[model samples]
Target: MIQNSKLFIAAAATLVAAVVLNPTPEQHRARIKEAIAERSPLAGFLGVGALTAFASTYHPLGLASYTTVNDHTVSIGVLGMVFVLQPSKDT
Candidate 1:
């Protein structure tokens, strides 16, 4: 438990530092997709919902997220915390 806490702290700190220095979502193509997706209100709405589900770690919304470290994958958000997302399967 203590080791998991430490890893979570370290990962959170690193994620925050990286974002502060480069405050953008993890992917370049995401920006493009966001631009395209937001053009329609439905897409924007679902995008917001998906983001909320991702943040809240709610499965009913069908939004799943994970990250990989040293070839090991770990959950992020209402599950476990470590690593940033690799890439979205869609877009």
Candidate 2:
């Protein structure tokens, strides 16, 4: 429990850093794809195309995004905190 929470917090911090540094979805995807490539070549190759497909709306200090490759997940970030969710396939 505590260990899992720590890992989750670390992941969230890393994700926030990535988002902050890579403000655009394309840049963020590329960074993630590179990381994936480092671990698995095949998935990285496949990621090239899927990761390219994303729609985003950004505000002066925040962003809202929809990514197909992430199981149709929608993500929103404000004040450095990010939230993500996958809607039902039926929708």
Candidate 3:
């Protein structure tokens, strides 16, 4: 679990660095699309992770915390879906 967290941090850092380097507009769009695709699974994993972490911290109410995390995750996922489907400026 610790290892997974480290990996997620590394991946996010790399992504931030790549974006900060500032590719061309087309490259940026492509990168965004690729990133959204690649990180989709991570997003779900993060939701689960958050739930687990919450469980560890709060103890007794873990199930309810997990459900809340899941709900938030779904909302975020839906928002991302909307973002991905929106027409690009280049289009």
**Best candidate according to TM-score:** 2
Better TM-score candidate (2, 3): 2
Per-residue lDDT of 43 in model 3? 47
Question: Over 4 Å off in model 3, which ranges?
Answer: 24-91
What is the TM-score of each predicted model, taking all chains together?
Answer: 0.25, 0.31, 0.26
Among residues 3 or more apart in sequence or in different chains, the pairs in candidate 1 whose N, CA or C atoms overlap within 3 Å are: none
Q: What stretches of model 2 exceed 4 Å from their correct place?
A: 1-22, 45-91
Residue-wise C-alpha lDDT for candidate 2, range 1-91, written one tens digit per residue: 9999999999998768655653455544444445545556886677742353333333333333433443443444344434443336687
Top of the candidates by lDDT: 2
Q: Model 3, range 1-91, lDDT digits (tens) per residue?
A: 9999999999987666544543332332333344444557674445643343243221112112111122222111211121113224653
Deviating ranges (above 4 Å) for candidate 1: 23-91
Q: Give lDDT tens digits, candidate 1, residues 1-91.
A: 9999999999998766554444122332243335434555786666752453234321111123433334433233222222234334653
The 0-to-1 C-alpha lDDT of every candidate, in the order given, reads 0.40, 0.49, 0.36
lDDT of 2: 0.49
lDDT of residue 48 for candidate 2: 44
lDDT measured at residue 26 in model 2 versus the true structure, 0 to 100: 54
